[model samples]
Target: MKNIKFLIAGILFGIILSKTQVVSWYRIYEMFKFQSFHMYGVIGSAVLIGIVIIQLFKKGIIKDYLGNQINVKDKKKGFIRTLVGGSIFGLGWALSGACPGPMYVLIGQGALSVIIVLFGAMIGAFIYGVLSKKLPN
Candidate 1:
């Protein structure tokens, strides 16, 4: 019952993404090629919103649904690790035209092709899980 709110929010978010063409492979491709500002604008706005939300959390201005204190951990700056991880993520996004969340939305919108991307993502996650202990922190 209480989870209905989350479902509604998810639906709204998917609708917005679909309407804004954020789920479109063409838009993603244009962004990657620097041929369009549409995707970059959307991503920039999201990053700004995220920064604001994180700052609010850090200042204790917002609480969880249960009203508990929310703690934002400071991430360690590791240039090499971040470079490697970001490169892998960017490569996957460039190839698939959608990240994980948007991949689900694309599937819901009847894009069956994204299922292959989702399957590959699942396999990658499984491999990461298997190799996590052997990999660096």
Candidate 2:
């Protein structure tokens, strides 16, 4: 299948996340408690890498699978929205011990408990979708 590559890429990413311990609840706890630099360092590296990739996209150095230049949209400034949304996300991550991305990895690693977190995330996303129109733009 043409989509097999994407599945492979996802598996690779999951392996990296697992091996780096980025998906570890202990690492997450350390990050929240400011008790260790491991997670912070990983996050900082990711931010730096994201900045570079975004710049590449903006400069037309990156292209989609269809060979079209990737479009980068300017984000609208919203401090209150960001604060509230980030706080909620952080609370969920702290309590669930896994970010949404790693929820699948947790499951793959035999953490059936993460099904509860995945369910909660899905429900939250659905609620947000329903309320998005009513919320601030």
Candidate 3:
């Protein structure tokens, strides 16, 4: 029953993403290019709502997922690490015109060319996993 609920939730999310056109590469590219605010607006609104919820729940005022309290801890990384990671991520997004989520959507939409991006993503993830222990925590 839990697995069925999870599957149904995933399907519902995919349907909503498709219906909202949020999975469109053109929409993502437009947001990246700053030619359209639609995608950013949606994301920003989500962030805002999340922030409000977290704040209200932080005092043990609300239950969390699985009825546990959120840790409310901030994980800090070095500035250099943040800059380097952001630059690499931005370059990939710019080049592909699709972020990870949209890349999967593109594949589902029958864009065979997206396989190259997916392959690269998989390789990148593998390399990251291999190097992760060597990198600072």
Candidate 4:
């Protein structure tokens, strides 16, 4: 019941991603190669929208879908951790031509090949979960 709405929304999002060719591996490759601006435009638009949404949430100008107040908190900055994590993420995306979000969308679009990437992601997450307590905050 309540979760059905999210399921529908996810389906809609997947459709949009497919129609826009945002889930295409070639587009992602082009983005990394600087041979096309199409994916950059898409990413920039998303970032702008995210900034606006975050600002609205922080200002109490908008609430979540369920009507709860949105609280934006600033976490302690970890520059080294951020740099290392981002580097690893970028390397993985470059190698796989897909990030986690688009990986699922690609799977939804019948890209069974992306299952390997998803499996690796799950393994990485499991390792992180197992070692998080021993890692830095």
Report backbone clashes per prediction: 0, 0, 0, 0
Give per-residue lDDT, candidate 1, residue 21.
Answer: 93
Residue by residue across 3-122, what tens digits does model 2's lDDT show?
998999999999999999999999999999999999999989999999999999899998877799988999989999999999999999999999988999999999999999999999
lDDT scores of the candidates, listed in order: 0.92, 0.94, 0.80, 0.90
For candidate 3, the per-residue lDDT at 33 reads 82
What's the TM-score of each model vs. the native? 0.94, 0.97, 0.78, 0.91
Segments in model 2 whose C-alpha atoms lie over 4 Å from true places: none
**Model 1 bad stretches (over 4 Å):** none
- TM-score ranking from best to worst? 2, 1, 4, 3
**How far does residue 83 in candidate 4 sit from its true spot (Å)?**
1.0
Find the candidate with the highest TM-score and give its number: 2
Best by lDDT: 2
Give the 10-residue window scoring lowest on summed lDDT in candidate 3: 97-106
**Is 3 or 4 the stronger prediction by TM-score?**
4
Colliding pairs, model 3: none
Model 4 — which ten-residue stretch has the worst lDDT?
A: 101-110
TM-score head-to-head 1 vs 3, winner: 1
Give each prediction's root-mean-square deviation over alpha carbons: 1.2, 0.8, 2.5, 1.4
lDDT for position 85 in model 2 = 97
Better lDDT candidate (2, 3):
2
